[model samples]
Target: MSSGLPAGVDLTNTLLILGGVGLVTLLLRALPFAAMRYFRESALVAWLGIAMPAGVMTVLVMYTLVNSTENPGGIGAALIAVVATAALHLWRRSATMSILFGTVIYMLLVNLVF
Candidate 1:
């Protein structure tokens, strides 16, 4: 115990505190899914489930492209990734494949190509 301290913090207490924090974080993350399950039949919930992904993705794409101008890559990496994503999605009609290919292309360009 420190000077005048009632009880000193030790490994046990520290681990307990961290575990409580982790549990809280897990519950917080799961809250949205719990709500979704409870509101599955609500029209607003159904609309958001269908529309939120595209809306969020569009915002992310815009953010990345807008931020790419500050670097020396001439926006090539971002542009290539965008094109790859669009092309793959258009050709295969699969969001997962499009996003995967786009991410790979961006990483390759940033690490090796440009």
Candidate 2:
């Protein structure tokens, strides 16, 4: 059977291009996992696994604090939420309670302030 592609688009060339792309995609994804296998027993990898997530969380929290004031009453609500979260954590040392309290406080503050 003849290739169904439009004129000038050779079937063999199209297959080669698709195969190259698939190989590159597979290598790109597998390279990182292969590198991780080498570092499976290393202290650096262990520390990085822990520290990277903590660093990401800290950056996200700071970003939210900084950007919360873009709309009306957002700043005050965020402030209240942060304070409430802190207070809950301080009192009970419970992350779940702190998050719950913080969310409620934030909602209340937003409704009242805006």
Candidate 3:
């Protein structure tokens, strides 16, 4: 057992610090909901509600595209899928068909070419 932690370190003394940090995190996460109750008609809240989801989606898409090219054949397969998706979307104006077609094309390309 350790009598006391090294300099600048103490698990026993850090419990309260950790708890305070956790509490702050919880409060920050809950702040948007709390603000909604008090300022339901605030333009800032309304704008954030709309923009946040769009921003999240943009980030997710960028992350996916960035992480998808680890393998040698990934770029070609992704290109085929994107082209198929775009074609389906343009020709039929159907998001479901576009996604389905893209997935199928991607799988087929990966299996056959790579």
Among all candidates shown, the one with the greatest TM-score: 1
What C-alpha lDDT do the candidate models reach, one value each? Answer: 0.84, 0.80, 0.75
- Candidate 1 on 1-114: residue-level lDDT in tens? 344424665767777999999999999999998887778789988899889989988998898799888754549899989998999899999888888888888888878887
Q: lDDT tens digits, residues 1-114, model 2?
A: 677799889999999999999999999999999898789999988999879855864675577689887855677777777877888888998867776788777777777766
- On residues 21-86, what C-alpha lDDT tens digit does candidate 3 reach at each position? 999999999998887787888898889988986586457446645766984457777776777777
Clashes of 2: 0
Top-lDDT candidate index = 1
Sorted by lDDT, highest first, which candidate order results? 1, 2, 3
lDDT of 1: 0.84
List the candidates' TM-scores in order.
0.77, 0.54, 0.45
lDDT of 1 at 35: 82
Rank list by TM-score:
1, 2, 3
